[model samples]
Target: MRYACRPVGLLSRSDPISRFDVADVQRFYPRGRPPQPATFDWSFTMNLLGVLPYWQLGPWELGPLTLHSFGLSVAIGVALALSILGSRGQKILGVSGDRMQNFGMWLLIFGWCFSHVFEVVAYQPHIILEDPLVLFKVWGSISSVGGLIGGVIAFLIWRVRNPYEDHIGWSNVAAFTLPIAFFFGRIGCALVHDHPGADATNFVVWEWIRSIFGDSLPEVWPLALQYPDGVPRHDLGFYEAIIFFFLTLFVLYKGRKPQRRGYYLWTLPLLYAPFRFLFDFLRVTPGEAGLHGDTRYLMLTPAQWVAIGMFILGLFLWSKLRNEPLETWKGLEKSTSDDEEPESSSE
Candidate 1:
């Protein structure tokens, strides 16, 4: 929870020299302190339904453990997703929770690698190509799209191994659980001030959200270039968190009795692609050019291009797999009860 050095007491004119503190020392001097920079600023926060909307609790300290927001969010999200997948997966897929969780673990690892690798290749190709070894760096952060692609590949490989598993049913289970991870991941980004919003000074939507929260959220100072209340950036991370929260609710609702079961795989991408594509307009991704997060490709970002492709894939997959029977993992067709009498020998 502790940030950097504590704020130095108000400098007294009577004893300016002796009263000189870290703040005073850093005022004229460059680079601040030697080890830890004196960069602690009071951040305003508000809690809603036990969750902090904008609380910047730097790092959690629990006894001997010290956990950062990104790491903690990842841990919590993975746990929640796996828990739901394990329990709900059994009901839908007839696979034990333990096995489902193990499969999910594989998906996560592969997905994370793909996501990070893709992010670098798309955003910072020069850096990636220059040093291909960077891919092995465990500490390096990853992106979501690439991660999910890798995860899906892992899942498909698992499916090949487990021939008894139902494709549509497993897809539904995955669709239902993924948003939970994304919800927490976005919240982590917001808390850590990772991906900031694009310049909304002239182009914007915070007014709608701002109108609702009003005084609860702090107002940003122009040119602040920071979190909590820095430069009124669009708060894109929080917006994404909101999107995933709603998506989670929708997926859970559909999972109850999916009419077109397998289409969950299709539907999820359809839903997410547009949201991501549109939201990119409000983001500021760092790259060789600058903070041009909106469009990564010739004019569109890699995500936007992927979004367009996903939309097409969704349309194709939905038509092809819509008729898959519900609970295909259990059986594609219902079996006759042993108690029921069979037809007579004579037709």
Candidate 2:
């Protein structure tokens, strides 16, 4: 692929370089409105001869691990997420109390555990037995559902321990943050095109992305790229990123001022669970189809069924919480105080 720069009007101006163009060349405004500048196609050309310029710094002993840019990018994203969370300080559901902070910290730890454990149990069981380095090897294969389960488990356990406390879970906030992580992760995925999925139609947005990246290459490079076949078009990640972005914005909108107990919490499950259940169809899972048509022991994938339960559970909780006295929840008072300006206006 050959890289080309689009010509801006200033760059494309017909005037030749002169001594007058050097210093104090300001205040030259055109009297009339000019035509809108047209966009140019910036692309690069590549062939076998052109693909030799890019070189891998790592050893070729590992088949798929030849110094991939995707891994490095994801590591940076993870670091960014950690930094953001740290800067924000520990808080639970907008209430920055000690109990809430403790709950949030525990929720994150167990959630990480759940996500990884589920990935290992559901898909790659053999890795446990065969690879001594399995712990390190299995970082990327985690299931999102597993993480959710883990986080929920942490929440429930914490809820039990602190039965009197009425506060929203930080997992909801994490759920909001999770997508930002995924957005960055998808970018990494797009950079490497390494996630598992077949090439889609020519008209996909990612197809355009691939083309643009393909064009940025030097004439000769040896970077791992999407072939004509097996071009990883992770549309699921794309959609998930959108969901997370909006959810994050909504959380900021709704939870920034705080609310009564379980308001934002229920909103998350209501929005996420059912949608996730439906979207799971787009995901490629191990043994999705079985001997007897589609496996329906639990009626759907284990994760899908969990999503269904979550949806129903959310509905039930939202109905119950809606009628509860607002004073019972600690965050409602905080919301009232913190958002005193918004509360003063008519509802």
Candidate 3:
């Protein structure tokens, strides 16, 4: 959902952002003296305004296995996406459920592997230089944009292997379902407060909201998370979760009717890339020892670069597919039946 790497021996041993604890604030500073209070006291206005309390859900142990809430949420998201893909493939693309499931599994494997690789290679090249083996550790770190790139690669590979498949139709299916997965994946990020952003205390819109509450509003925005120094910063993950939730609804509504083959494949990227590029601006910059922030190059994060590419790709697809015919469920089913019918026996 966001870029994060566990502490290697060479890197800062401070806990991962997801694992940040209020107690750790004291230790984060010199001589056990935090610059400000490590906790906040919410007022009635904050509660009424739906400001979330600072909370962290740690991993749970089951026998020898550890279950993290983020991982569990991702698992659920993937499962839901696969289910939708399987069902929709048959009805909308004339692709079988089994085939869709196989495709989804491949996408999942490749998406996960690439997510780790992108994180290690693009965001933290230093990690790879330190230990070459870190590249093989697929569970180490991940980027959401990396997963998207992986999904595209996986689609290309699948198309090559199954050349007769309806590539455009399948792409539409994937584009429609991906937001559902992302919605939950981002929720996991929000739960952990991993994607921290710049200070929102004086953000104009938040300031306006605060003004509405008069003196009853707390100094910190209800949606903001306090850093070790007690500065309230926007939680980018939380904001994204809310955005994706609405996006999922929008796409679902669109999917209810027949549309062009590449409608979603192009439109989704066009809609999402610009917002994502803007959101990264709010992401915290690299902090002490490169902890608690995203890596940037040329004044832009890796995801911003990827977003630019996505926008370009979306434009290309839109230009090419704009003239294509719309595809309906019944039409796809009839075409599939016609293709499956055996040729008449020769005399």
Which candidate comes out best when scored by TM-score?
3
Residues 291-317 of candidate 1: C-alpha lDDT, one tens digit per residue: 435336786777777788888888888
lDDT (Cα, tens digit) per residue for candidate 3, span 113-204: 99999988988898777899998999788889999999899989989998987788877888889999999999999877778788766777
Predicted structure 3, TM vs. truth: 0.77
Q: What is the C-alpha local distance difference test score of each model?
A: 0.68, 0.52, 0.80
lDDT of each residue in 28-84, candidate 2, tens digit only: 323343323334333322333221111122223466656555566556656655554
Q: Which 10 consecutive residues of model 3 have the lowest summed lDDT?
A: 1-10
| Candidate 2 global lDDT | 0.52
Best by lDDT: 3
lDDT of model number 1 = 0.68
User: Would you list the clashing residue pairs of candidate 3?
Assistant: none
Our model 1 lands, by Cα RMSD against the true structure, at 16.7
